[model samples]
Target: MDDAYDELLLRGRVYGADHEDPGPRPGRAYRELVGGPLDGLLLDVTGWDAEALATGAALSTHLGRHGGEGRSHYEPRPTDPRRWDWTADTP
Candidate 1:
């Protein structure tokens, strides 16, 4: 066992087995998704520009609002730059 192994165990303890592991995202930028089917998930926007960030994105998720796979739309909140508000869902 080495430092990587120790980090793996630490990640499991921090995020649990079911939750997504949001470990050190070096050089990667992300925004917290709020509401909709993808709540509590981080949306990676590493290479997005200001225009792209403003336009938002449609994220695919297996947990649809009506109970099937669908796409969730999210837009950056006017008040918060680090969070995206879930606006709608389509199955």
Candidate 2:
């Protein structure tokens, strides 16, 4: 287990697997990724019944400064006011 954990950490550091940017320190990267206004919703996974504490620690470790960089593949849609129609919004 220990060896696996160490290997994982090393891989994370090397590839910035979880946003572990090579230049910055780990704590700063973590805070930048996990913090900010959306932090509440992002961090609140209670409904998933997941292991919050352990997950947090692991994230803090493997994510380094950037926080799970390649783990997520979401791309933000282009922001165009015309794309939204407040008059007839539907789910």
Candidate 3:
């Protein structure tokens, strides 16, 4: 819980677990470091670098557009973004 636990706590306290902000979620690095389903799903976004930010953006967009739309996770789909409430419905 050392990695960004403070951030999560703050979010939970302030946002009450319903808020969906892409800034605080644990990245692939933490997941991989621990090794689990979380390793995936999330891209390794340790530092606030450009690549990490891009990866996060791609992850959010992909999850929202493709995953949210219920498209096959097998075949890659284009990122057709729409204004969806990720706070209530996360992909």
Q: In model 2, state the lDDT of residue 72.
A: 23
What tens digits encode model 2's per-residue C-alpha lDDT throughout 1-91?
Answer: 3575334333332213334344323322211122221221122122332343223322222222345341321111134211111111111
The whole-model lDDT of each prediction reads 0.68, 0.25, 0.28
- Lowest-sum lDDT 10-residue window in model 3: 80-89
> What is the RMSD of candidate 2?
15.9
Itemize residue pairs with steric clashes in candidate 1.
none
Tens digits of per-residue lDDT for model 1 on 1-91? 4575345333322211235654535465666677887776666677899998998888776676745467888999999766789899887
How should the candidates be ordered by lDDT, best one leading?
A: 1, 3, 2
Considering every candidate listed, which one attains the maximal lDDT? 1
Model 3 Cα lDDT, one tens digit per residue, 10-46: 3332111233554334332221111121222322334
Q: For model 3, how big is the CA root-mean-square deviation?
A: 12.9
Q: What's the distance in Å from true for residue 83, model 1?
A: 0.4
